[model samples]
Target: MIKCIAIDDEFLALEIIENYVSKCPFLELAGTFSSPLEALPLLNECGCDLLLLDINMPEVNGMDFLSAIPNPPLVVLTTAYPQFALAGFEAGVVDYLVKPFSFERFLKAIQKAQSRLAPRPAGGTGYLFVRSAHRMIRVDLDDILMLEGKKDYVAVHTQTQVIDTLTTLTAFQDKLPVKDFVRVHRSFIVALNKINTIERNVIYMGDKKVPVGEMFREDLLRRIG
Candidate 1:
């Protein structure tokens, strides 16, 4: 369920939104506030996936409130004024619900927020980040030749360079997609796509040769088949 909070200066507007939220199975109303100022502390403490906000609230309007947050939650603006529709979208709102909106309209807004929060498409560009030394480094899975485990640390061997990361081979294995990479030995993992030759029990990536463990041989052959 998407955890959400509602904020409106009008008590009746808050009640209507709370009721609408209750009806949606995909939504969970974490809290409701008549004053946006009073809701700030609760919002920070409870956390939320989405914010149902009214634009014309006293003290601080919804647009200004959302702008103040560095990384605000997905917003669905609720107000009688259609004039602020363009402004709301500029502030990164998922959807704008003109007040006195139907339950169906509210549901559509929630669905829009859900789409934004959804995970990226699978096989995501075949790249990921790993921490090396004191910094995070981007490593392209397609460019990786092999991975070698040195106890608590693992070295990622790419086409042009070797990156020593502060993570184990097992941990790296779990992160890589099974279709493009495989764990062939206890201390070694190889990129199946980058394998140039397999001689006896050894796999070769350019000049680098990695021994394939006996236990992983059958699975490797099956995958390659």
Candidate 2:
């Protein structure tokens, strides 16, 4: 079972999340807090596997709170603001849920997070079975060049072809091994070995140019060398 905590200043919001957590057989709700500050100590002590965070809080915002935590648990941002979605993904949040979301939507998000945190076999050939339009396609890790985000969906660009899926870039990032794939932008994640050249703010993979975000530049440079 996934140990989880919910943080939101709104009492009703917290209640809703509590109800959702109670229903999920695989989830164990460790605690709930109105203050992000109070939640920090509990998180540090217990080391929760998942966090349901609110973007808008009193003293410290959700984004700032997440930044302060070192190696935070897989976060699912529960907020009314949709604009923070991209920034949340950039901050390594597993999923973003706009307030007043249906139970089905919440389940989908949690399932995605569970899949992300699930353990894999050691030192084996890492492959992902993705369902395309009509058939399930098995994709080898070595063939993937980069993953591009287009709104809610992601396009996995491989050496042979580009496969589109109704999934978030953050979700894909969680599944890919960090040593092999690195997220260089809110919209892009590239295979480390496939990098041909780095010039200014862009990365060259043969002829294609992928722009690197300012925030991710430092990590990308360190990886390149």
Candidate 3:
């Protein structure tokens, strides 16, 4: 079961989420909090695997609160404002639920969280399976040299070959371990250890060169340096 906590300043909102959590067989409602501040102590004490958080709260809003926590659990942001969706994803939230959302929509979000937390092959293996042409292909994380996004698909550049899959670059970025990979541009996510050299605003990964955007340059330099 996925242990979870619901935090919403609105009492009715929390009640709806709590009821929804009870209906899901795979979910266990650990606690419900109407106050974001009070929820902090309970979060550490109870220990949860998922968090149902409200993005707009008094004093400490959900987005900032999630950011402050180190290695936060899978989160689903609940907000009336749609503008916060992008920021929520950037903060690593698994999904976003606009207020007054249906149970069906809520269930779909939880399903995504389940897939994300699903157990991989045991034994310290650093690899993930990506779907391609109705078949699942195992790609070793260490073999990845860089990732290039092309519209709807992303090309995973490995040392020997490129694996093209029908997935967004942001999706791959979220799954990749942050300590080993960094997004250097809107269309490029590069492996820190596989970088051959950085000249100007370009990253050379073997024979391929990926351009680095100005916004992501500082972080990329800090990670490599």
Candidate 4:
């Protein structure tokens, strides 16, 4: 596995990278940090093979962070700004992914990392465990249709059952495969393959209609498209 560390001030961005890392069997998540300064210790340790560094951050910027390290690992810079792409490439980044990037795009970056680091092996299973009724329940990735968020719980909707898990939506979302599952709304996350169709801004899944949040509409569309 090509071990990797991610640094992003945005908690949501870190969450997205964490989820993406989970999907790639060849990529191992070594660590994640909210601040670039906090990551200096780990970077100095040289335990990772790749760095998913965000460009816009406090304490120190991505370019500065790159410059601080001697013999840095393969880097895939993530940012909202396109202007930094040239600088990132000039500074020797493996790839550059703009904000709200797709899993397919992330894979391209990983491909570059693998070319320089290690060859990818086989993949993993299609299931994950979730805490429900004080017990961990095994939910198959293929069985999951949608996830509905409650106050302090998540309704795990599968083809045969709807298991009520004791966890926040964001927490549950972290456990899912980033490529297949998407948080369309604050209260809902749906499997891309399970979506029957989309009418207007809502997603159609058999008898259910999931409302897409304005913030996540573009991402949802990109995933389905």
* Candidate 3 residue lDDT tens string, 18-130: 88988998999988987668888877676788899997888798877886664467789998999998776655577899989999999988887786676645686488898
Model 2 lDDT at residue 78: 98
**Which of the numbered candidates is closest to the native, going by highest lDDT?**
2
C-alpha local distance difference test of each model? 0.79, 0.87, 0.82, 0.81
Which tens-of-lDDT digit does each residue in 21-132 have in candidate 2? 8889999999999999888788988789899999899889998888777657778999999999988889767789999998898998888777767654578657897767
lDDT of 4 by residue, 1-225 (tens): 888999999999999999999999988898999988898888887658889999899789988878767556768999999999867654546788999999999998887667555322348446878787778888878899999988888899998998998776755654565557777887898989889988888888999889987756765676667
Against the true structure, candidate 3 reaches a TM-score of: 0.70
Tell me the RMSD of model 2 versus the true structure.
4.1
Clashing pairs in 2: none
lDDT assessment of candidate 1: 0.79
Ranking by TM-score: 2, 3, 1, 4
Segments of candidate 4 deviating more than 4 angstroms: 119-225
Q: Give model 2's TM-score versus the native structure.
A: 0.73
Which pairs clash inside model 3?
Answer: none
lDDT of 3 at 195: 86
Candidate 3: RMSD to truth: 4.8
After superposition, candidate 2 runs with Cα above 4 Å error:
121-124, 129-137, 148-181, 191-212, 217-225
Q: Decide which is better by TM-score, 2 or 4.
A: 2
Window of ten residues with lowest summed lDDT in model 4: 116-125
